[model samples]
Target: MQFSIATPTAAEFAALYLETGWGQWPLETFERALAGSWVVCVARDDDNRLVGLGRLIGDGALHAFVTEMIVSESARGAGIGAEIVRRLVGEAHRRGVRDVQLFAARGRAAFYERNGFARRPDDAPGMEWAGESRGTAVP
Candidate 1:
């Protein structure tokens, strides 16, 4: 396995989403998101196939949020995901950003915890609003 800071092409990134059951987000949205991220990292197998991906998206100075973190199911037990998080966090710290945050998938909090993320306290909850609840949900 090899890790690279290079950003994956939109197709490769969307494929990662599908492989991880994260749904196939449209390529155009992905292109825009990728353009906006401050840092992106991809892991490739010895064969040069994209096996894992993670990225950081946020304002450059004060806060950073991590999302779209995924490691191929086949690659999960090898610490690739942690490495990706470490690299992203390292970069964020180097840039003097302290308010890094991420939402872990169900049952994955421990993974994030081990990677130096802590749960936000009940007093400080994370909330979301989905555009006034149109009959359909996009996420």
Candidate 2:
């Protein structure tokens, strides 16, 4: 299986989101959010079908966060996810982002660990705002 990385347009990103069951976000919503992104990476198979996507968002210098990292179920074990993360990290580093972060779901920690991420101390907890808006609020 051949893999290649490219920056995706808003429509492409939204399609990948739906395919991966990340959420049901519309193209307009994706366009608005992607416009603020520092970079977006998409991994595709030889046939040019999108298999994975990840994004880095921030002020384009000091900090960035990885979001929407996902791979299609059919492509999960083919290392596409790792490639997506690797590409996103490379892009963030190239932009001189001093800090990059991502919130991995439970059972997915090992995946990030393999990509050079270390688990933070338990004392430093991860928090989120559970609501329809999906806006993370600090408690």
Candidate 3:
């Protein structure tokens, strides 16, 4: 396995998504996601096929959020995912960004924890706004 800070093309991204049972995102969304990421790291097999991916989206100096972290099923147990997290975290730390965070997929918290992330406290759990919900509450 080899890793590089290269952004995969949309076709590569789509293929991996489908290959891993994650439905494909639209091309435009892929483009926007990649464009908005502060860093993207891709892992390739010996034959140079994209087998793992991870990226950070942040304001470059203060916050870096890890997302879209996936390793192809064939490569799942090879430590590629952990390495990807290390690289992403290394980049953020290098920039002196201390607010790194990620929403681990269900059943994936141990993986992130092993890579040095901690779960949010119950009272400070992450929240998401549903697109269909009315934003009626104001502070």
Candidate 4:
């Protein structure tokens, strides 16, 4: 697989998301998310299929959140997702961002640990404002 910071179309992104069993979302939502991202990294197979994708979102220099690290079902266990996370984190550091964070999917802490992330202290202060208008977006 080849990895690069180039982005894929929203259609391709949504398709890859679906391929991961994450269900479906509108292409425009994907488009807006891509447009607002600080950076996007993609991994493609030999045939140039969109097999993996990762995004870094935040101010370019001081903070970044690594989100949507995705690898197609067929491409899982091949290190594509890990490499994508590495690249995103590297890009954040390269930009001098000292605050980097990511929300790991449930039961996926081991994967993040392998990618050089540690658990936040149990007492770390954080909260969610899950208001009625909030929408669900997870993978």
Candidate 5:
């Protein structure tokens, strides 16, 4: 497999996301998310098919958030996801970022923990607010 900083097509990203059992999102939504993201990494097989993808979004200064991490079902056990995370985090470090954050899906916390992420402190709880015009974009 090969990994590189990439801007993947909406179809490739949508296929990978579907592998996670998440509902299909529109191509435009995927494109819009990539347009606003700070960093992106994609893994391709020997055949040059996209098998993994992840992104980082933040101000690129003190804080960065890891998001949209997904590895195709056929490629999950090969450490592609971990490599993606490692590269993303390493890029954050290179940018002088101080905090890297992510909201891991249920049952996937162990993966992030193994990558050096810890649960939020007792004083800090994860929260969200969908605005009145909640967009369809993944966040």
Candidate 6:
């Protein structure tokens, strides 16, 4: 697998995002979001097909968080996800971002831990603004 990570063009990013079930946003919305992100990393296979993606968003200094990490179902378990995280963290470091963070889904904490992320007891709770009901609510 000849893979590479780079900042994807807006169109390429939107295309891969749709492939990963983020089709709710219109193309224009995707373009806007892509332009606003501090950094976006895409993983491509030997054939140059996009197999994974991740993005970082925050002010240019002091804070940043990795988000939207997704790998094509067929590409899972092949270290593509790890590569994306590695690249994203590298980008943050290069930018001199002071606080890089990511929220792992349940049961996936070990994966991030392996990548050098530690649980933070001093961090405040995080929240999300869901635009639509997903049959759940915060306590």
TM-score against native, each model: 0.85, 0.79, 0.86, 0.85, 0.85, 0.76
Give the better candidate number (3 or 4) by lDDT: 3
For model 1, how many clashes? 0
Instruction: Candidate 2: list runs displaced more than 4 Å.
Output: 1-5, 126-139
lDDT measured at residue 128 in model 6 versus the true structure, 0 to 100: 25
**lDDT of model 2, residue 37:** 70
CA lDDT of every candidate: 0.78, 0.70, 0.79, 0.78, 0.79, 0.70
> Which is better, 1 or 2, measured by lDDT?
1
Candidate 3 lDDT over 1-139, as tens digits, reads 8998889998888898899988977888888878888989999999999999999888976667887798999888889998998888777666666567778788988777777776777987632212221223322
Looking at model 3, the pairs that clash are: none
Best by TM-score: 3
State in Å the error of residue 128, model 1: 17
lDDT of 4: 0.78
lDDT of each residue in 23-136, candidate 4, tens digit only: 788889999989999989999999999999999889865567777888898889999988998788767666666466777788887787777776676686221212222222
> Which has the higher TM-score value, candidate number 4 or candidate number 6?
4
lDDT of 1: 0.78
Q: Cα miss at 57, model 1 (Å)?
A: 0.7
lDDT of 6 by residue, 1-139 (tens): 5444456666777777777776666777778877778888877777887788888898876667877787887788999888878777777666766467777776876777777676656455432221122223323
RMSD of each: 9.8, 8.4, 8.7, 9.1, 8.8, 9.9
Tell me how candidate 5 scores on lDDT. 0.79
**If both were scored by lDDT, which would come out higher, candidate 2 or candidate 4?**
4
Q: Could you tell me how far off, in angstroms, the CA of residue 115 lies in candidate 6 after the best superposition?
A: 1.2
> Which stretches of candidate 3 lie above 4 Å from their native place?
126-139
